[model samples]
Target: MSDDDATGDTATKPGDDRGATYASFVAIGDSFTEGLSDLAPDGTFRGWADLVAEHLAALTPGFRYANLAIRGKVLDQVLEEQVPSAVAMGPALISLCAGNNDLLRPNGDPDALAKRLAKGIRELRATGAEVLLFTGVDPRDSPVIRHARGRFATYYLHIRSLADLYGCRLVDLWSMQGLRDWRAWNPDRLHLNETGHRLVAAKVLTALDVPDAGEWHKTWPLPTAPTASRTENARWAREHLLPWLGRRLRGTSSGDGLPPKRPNLTEWP
Candidate 1:
């Protein structure tokens, strides 16, 4: 978006809560925002978006939050299903994180993904709400996903560009040094573990200029370091990678027929 394109300041920087008294928040994306591996005691996803919402609720009375993200969704799906609804609600703030599922594909194009994302941001901003954008984590360390590092890096650049152009708040997860640890990931190595999700929540809150986002940025130690044993790799391939491939080959999605965890903007619990 150009300077003449956007109407409001939307969001500025680290602590630029300058008139940013966001009373309502809507998160639209994919599994990451849906909370994935970060499960509540009830075995449901409660990822970073929820944490941010909870914190914001305490700060503002009647603060409402909605997360319309479903697992296995790509950028197109999110824009089609969730973006329209979020735009209709006209929340004070909207955070969007997606496109990784597309980039993971053999035919994924970073430039195309960025263009699609930029279009969404433009539409969301037109609703007079702030947009919070996220960059994908570095994939250099993961053997399975390492080959996509170049693509992800390119996508990150586009993400930053769009955020700057649109004056949207940015939660640059690729800059999170703590994510380099394997313990921050689930056994599948494709999603964030509880620790990783908590850290991401902190980053998002910080971007929104929320105080006391927590000490999740610190490099906390884990009981067990990540390993590269063949047996372990085999287990992951069998249980995670193979299944994911099978689903793709069968033209199915893990999130098929699933509903948004939080379909409406209600007071955060």
Candidate 2:
């Protein structure tokens, strides 16, 4: 298990999707899950969902990901569509990063929203998947989005309660990254860029207890200012976690003895 291979630690776990391994992963959410406005089709996991998958693949080996996230899905959509798919997969791990759209969509009934979301979570967990739930991020200020100032605290509570009732791991990204910086947001302010995504990934890994989680969070720096330069973003990705993630997927290695570490950007160069 070396950093060079970046994936040697869990590269061939028993449940990995490849071969006979039964381990499969599914993501459930809205546009954020859809990787909206993300630079590439591959980067469609514009936020933490993709990052979590990337890290889990390293630890679980042969792990396969089935992103069931859809655009503009609210609580109802999740219960109707995403939840059923995830339940059928019987995934080893399920990440539920949703509910932002429920808050933004017009005429959403909060009580009904909570009820449906809870049911969706209950069903996912019933399939024996270890559920990892994520809280929503604050919307970036935008002209087209009319209700930017709407209260979202209730959604957070509902999500947290569901996770607790289901006995699942919860990553409060809204608290960890969202409330901390306006800079962490993209220009559109709706989704995350590379650094934002990396931070979220680091948080998720820490929750999962993969060995390298600590290093990923502690070593990475966060920049006080957002970078408009895609080059800088690309460079950061190449130098850290993203490159290692690439190596693992390709079955390559860094040749070093260290485990592949997640990159953080709390204080980036």
Best by TM-score: 1
Off by over 4 Å in 1: 1-16, 222-226
Residues 1-269 of candidate 2 have per-residue lDDT tens digits of 12221211222112222222224567776656555444545442355666666666666656677666665455665668667867876767777776666565455555556666666666776676777788765444333233643546566666676666557777876666443453555554556665666677777767665556533232335766664467755564556546545654674433223211111111111
Q: Considering summed lDDT, which 10 consecutive residues are worst modelled in model 2?
A: 260-269
Best by lDDT: 1
TM-score computed on alpha carbons, candidate 1: 0.91
* Per-residue error (Å), model 2, residue 100: 1.5
lDDT per residue (tens digit) for residues 1-269 in model 1: 34333333454332345535579999999999998889888888888888888888888899999999999998899999999999999999999999999988888898888878877888888887889999988889887779989988988888887888777888888888898877788998988988898899888877777777776575756547457688899998999999999988997899999999999888777
lDDT, residue 227, candidate 1 = 71
The deviation in Å at residue 147 for candidate 1 is 0.7
